[model samples]
Target: MEKFYPEFSARFAQFLEHIRGRRIAIVGHARPDGDCIGSQVALARVLGTLGHEVLCVNPDLVPRRLQFLVPGMRFARTDEMLADRTDYTAIFVDCADHARAGERLKGRFPVVTGNIDHHLSSAGFAEWNFVDVHSAATAEVLAGMFFDNGLTVDAQTAQGLYTGILTDTGQFRFTSTTRRTFLLAAELMARGAKPTEAGFELYERETTGKLQLLERFLASLRMECGGRVCVGTLPNGIFEATGSTAEDTEGLVDYARCIDGVDVGVLIEERPDGAMKASLRAKNPAFRLDRVAAQFGGGGHACAAGLNYKGGAAGFREKLVAAIAAQIAAVDTPEEKK
Candidate 1:
């Protein structure tokens, strides 16, 4: 891939030249995370600085905490922009597939270009793809592109890049974070990225309702596989009692992962339609939650993944636990053989 960097860079440059005066739509996944939000915002800033018209389209409203990061971001909620079939270019960032853009925008535009991502699961969903799963964050990829292209990284650009790198890497604590991650982070900081301030705003700041939701999830924690796996559930009743919104449940899977003697953690949230959304976390390097999630029609990174089950809460919980247990058994069998 190193040998092809120059070629890829040249191709990307050509694509940027084509987009010079076009109306471009930058999109992220449905439920955007820091990496998704940051990549789109950073790309939008770069394009806007280049005198191109760009709109950042997010399926949902930007999280309250992230609103301050991308002040110029535009929210495109309806399918009209996508269906009009007008002369507009589409750029998807940090999404694994075009489907990740949501059904509303998929296959609606002709000239799809730009592919800034850090997920191995990305299906090369653009005319120009720049995917490096080894990178800790998509923002890292975008930052490098910006630097390579001679674009200036102002304070806001630095902030957006910092948030993307920080959250996706779990503040640089995840295994995927390497020397390159810190190197890029340091460079961004030198260009005015303040990690201390961004860290506090992104993680330290939480609402009371979110705290109550965390307590409820913690109370429902369960263990399995000789304490190698921990599971937790959040029922709608708990959400009602705590006045917690769905957004409040974001990062609750980390709680199960933090428990001592647990190699894998699972969080199941009961949806209003009786189905369940499962979030999986694996601390053990040998465990690949992405494979586990794919079995249920979902995919993500190795350590973290998610799946949606279409059954009653009881049945969904039962099947999910059994599936996770099977994966655990498969991993342990090799050790037993050894």
Candidate 2:
């Protein structure tokens, strides 16, 4: 058990010490992605082994693919957790802010005891915050802490950590993937994480509806800002027509981002209520898509961010394109900063 993130590990150890012997409820964001669910599962299993009563709570059900990581584990939906009315120490995992945990859960735990995340937009809304925007994933932070403290990572917990690291790193292809990420991934594999299993569940299990949804999204691709920006749309009825869901739109935006010469990629999802949810991705961190998303009250990493607007897709797209153009113009004008 070697220490990778010594400073973060020490801080996490102190946080754990403060909550020692208390009943803990681990909270994750609304849409529990691999990193969110994996972090919750891994931390809950580790903390439970440390003699604390722990349960993972989320606003939504675990996505179909991520369910495997929670097999035989204690996971409660937000409603269920609220029904308990139990007094417990609240720990949030992979949530950039308390709002990301949903308004209901945010109200339940007005003051978070512990907050662990890796999103650059994290609001640090906890008494004990261990946010590492540089880390690839929240699970990466917890994995480092687990190993640093000589804690045991059982097979299931290892799989959870491995899945988080794998997905958050974009299969280890994202810029955030560091040498420590690879090394910790290797350690998780040694501890019993099966990459093949994770890959099959994550990538190979795409549904036909998702493909149909992706088709519509691709068909809506439009280049702006002299082709440096690529924007796509999923119309209001597209999901219902394709029998797909919000989860299906997960990696669809990447298709636009991966295109040659596209520095910024945007996916605008039109909700049933006419609101538009925009997911933004950039190849270079300098673009600072997070700041761009913040203009619409959304936040995320520099390379990947999102926002929601209560307006028509056409108008939202126009406004977003203009914002992105301004960003590109500002970046091009290095003299402005000076």
State how far residue 319 of model 2 sits from its true place (Å). Answer: 0.5
lDDT of 2: 0.90
Prediction RMSDs, each to the true structure: 2.7, 1.5
Please, what are the lDDT tens digits per residue for candidate 2 over residues 1-338? 45788788777788888999999999999878999999999999999898999989999889998988998888888889879999989999999999898999998889899999999989899999999899999999988889888888999999999999999989998899999999999899899999999999999999999999989888999999899999998878887899998888999999999999999999998888988999999988888889899999899998999888875656678899999889888888978442
Pairs of residues clashing in candidate 1: none
Return the top candidate by lDDT. Answer: 2
Q: Which window of ten consecutive residues has the lowest lDDT sum in model 2?
A: 308-317
TM-score attained by model 2? 0.97
Residue 169, model 1: lDDT of 90
lDDT of 1 at 114: 77
Model 2: per-residue Cα lDDT at residue 64 = 95
After the best TM-score superposition of candidate 1, give how far the Cα of residue 96 lies from its true spot, in angstroms. Answer: 0.7
